[model samples]
Target: MNITISLKRRCEHVTEGTDEAGSGSLLNRIYTELYITEGQSEEVNTQHEKHIRVVLTNGVAGVGKTFSVQKFTLDWAEGLENQDVSLLILFSFRELNLIKDEQYSLLMLLHVFHPTLQKVTAEQLAVCKLLFIFDGLDESRLSLDFYNREVLSDVTQKSSVNVLLTNLIKGNLLPSALVWITSRPAAANQIPPEYVDRLTEVQGFTDAQKEEYFRRRFSDEDLSSRIISHIKTSRTLHIMCQIPVFCWITATVLDHMLTTDQRGELPKTLTDLYSHFLLVQTKRKKQKYDEGHETSPQELMEADREVLLKLGRLAFEHLEKGNIMFYQEDLEQCGLDVTEASVYSGVCTEIFKRECVIFQKTVYCFVHLSIQEFLAAVYMFHCYTNKNTKVLEDFQEKDWRYSRYSSDSSLDNFLRRAMQKSLKSENGHLDLFVRFLHGLSLETNQRLLRGLLGQTDNSPEIIQRAINNLKEMNSDKISPERSINVFHCLTEINDHSVHQEIQEFLKSENKIREETL
Candidate 1:
């Protein structure tokens, strides 16, 4: 088989921004710019040379790095883009981790993954144009250990995968082959700066791309236009749309609510949006049952609430451990069977895809990381409002888990502890949760959750305390990004009057005294 034929793979759900040559994206230019070999005449080889040997693409989670890599590789293989590249070999570190300790010759590595390559000579590797695309260095469990690993020149030499990877990256193996690596910014640092020829960051979607996405997503022109206009009108929502995954979530929630003619205002805050989406999914499932004329085992609405709380607990516990992927055991611990869990497949997403990883068994995760965070917040809200301890039966102390109905003092204590924990959390993982806690305390959101959960009267004292905490956090010592997020969180729960009050207080001479409070 031809190398290009052997390499052909489908690109799935790739969006508009990857190929567009916009001036804002330096990353696109770096990838598209063609380079020729130094010794060849410009006429003969100018288009054939691959400019950068190693391009490091960095982005936050859910910014579509994997999608872009798949799209690029497929485009090349299909002769739609980068025709100079004769072969593309793609590997994800998540899959690579399974064989990290194994030793293999370069040929063996290719053959194991792509048996069709066996007919090709190992010598062809050195002469043929090859592109190595490594996705998700952040997911890799193996230590690259660039400093400690010994380099090997021979491609056929046996070594651990990381050593082989280090050698290949350092130009000790297949020095001329083009390599591309994708990682989260934090993980991108693992590769030495000297070894990388080009660095690019995928900043998700631009405003034009966001417009294009909605236009493509919704066939109803008026509805699509309305959604676009709504997103543009909300400054917070517009900023969130820059992330493709967040855009998908927003589109999903808005599309359903709009189409169904749901009453009340569209959700503005992250918590409100996620809650609306969950309710939409539940109503959808209820409609399916109504259409089927089938007798469901439990009340469709009641089951929805039950499943959400269970899933929220699962999300919270797993997030605490920094575990995004879950196995059967994890689901079992949450009192969920595969069949029962599948009911949440629409909203929670089946993160436990069996086909993608080395684990033959299925794994589960939230559709997006933010969903997990939102669900975690929901779990916290449910616990505080209802005094539900079933979710926290494993914990011995329940000091902070008091019901909001318990007493003013208890609710105040819980909010203080929660805010303190959120402010101190590394990476702001709990930021959304904190926001949700505040948002859920609102009379509007509480009314929305009325039957699904117990009532949590919004406390003026707690709100004031939380506002003060945010003001303190916005101090110079805190990161500007964190301060900005704090501002967003305050907007979600506080009254408009409070926003102006905080703004005035921030500018006042008493700012230091307010910060002390």
Candidate 2:
């Protein structure tokens, strides 16, 4: 693809855009929305009978691993199930967190399969047949190797290190059925031996693929050719083109930017791409607002951490008085109203969709764990000067960088009503609150909480609460939210765990350490 198209053509037709705050939004929607790209899905159907069991899907962050797993699961259910057999149990390892053992993870999987398990203990699960899709091995905090297979005689005879040594240390954890794992190459060590033999990697779209997808999106051959050239040639855009989201970002950029073809340098870093991309997008969105568009969304804004915190704070403050999922009317109760607010909201939501920040269907969430980390970093650096005050209200395991999109007006309205109506109350709204919390990740949480605690308003209370939660969360009663949050709060900024933004945060501290240490 050439890099010399009009910016509008470059920016059009993205599935969604990427955001640092919007994590988990993309994968959650993948299997449910959009067709699985052919490059990845072609080989999936042939594996229905390979008694070998356990499949693994590998790719970079935004490639189609999770989506493929989901599509496979759905297809498997439609074909593989006979009258006696039923239900596939998919476990996202990202949801499992730093659980102590493969057995522990199995135990958790058992619980999800609990309703299906007639009388099986986690130990008894061996006899019971089921399917497992363990997603996100690379993103997990603990590193376990999976490439080579090994034998495990007994899991009960060892120490903590043995438990962590998954490749050589199998226990009652191995199931008697089908399973799959997904991850990127960088985090390959996190996968255990159980998955190595079953590994599958996602190769990016081919040039013909780009032509097919782009042409479907826009009819003009010359325009599609221009976009294809940019996708093939632009170095930074080239990286994104490898991932589906970047393809969408490319298309969206082509569609809107009037900057015309100035031979400006492309973004060198992911953040550079996002920042430049968002700037051009914000310009186009402002145009829609200027034209005087309105909707039923009560209030919407180009919700960043600042805007979300402001709105969520008021919502939380009001909800602290109770438990509810606030709606348009509830927004009014929170002393928030006016339709003009989310004008940026609806359009900004599209920003998330085009870039693949979240699912482009009815319910969406942040696309990656990194997005929330970035948002938390941004909030700590700029929004709240106080080191302890949390920037969000009613958070949970999955929050939206973008939720699913609906092309139908009625369906869109229905989902919005469902979301808004869900928010009308408090405690019952716990799920609603967490719907967005899904946007945060362990690594991101670890970076944001440990790194930014000093600059927060309620750092002491937050830290203590997290530690206390840790005390309560053991192998027996692990809380997903509790476990991940504790890991987030306790994990120091390990230099080994450096992200692109770490150096920026380290600069001020390095100066002080230079004088002291």
Clash counts per candidate, in order, are 4, 91
How high is the lDDT of residue 77 in model 1?
Answer: 66
| Candidate 1: worst-modelled 10 consecutive residues by lDDT | 17-26
Structural similarity to truth (TM-score) of each candidate: 0.76, 0.43
Candidate 2 whole-model C-alpha lDDT, 0 to 1: 0.40
Per-residue lDDT of 315-357 in model 2, one digit per residue for the tens? 4443334311223454455343435455236334543222211
lDDT of 1 by residue, 69-154 (tens): 86677668668898787678887776676687789877778777766677766688889888888898866667898896587888
Quote the positional error of residue 63 for candidate 1 in Å. 2.6
Candidate 2's displacement at residue 98, Å, is 10
lDDT of 1 at 256: 75
Q: After superposition, how far is residue 401 of candidate 2 from its true place, in Å?
A: 36
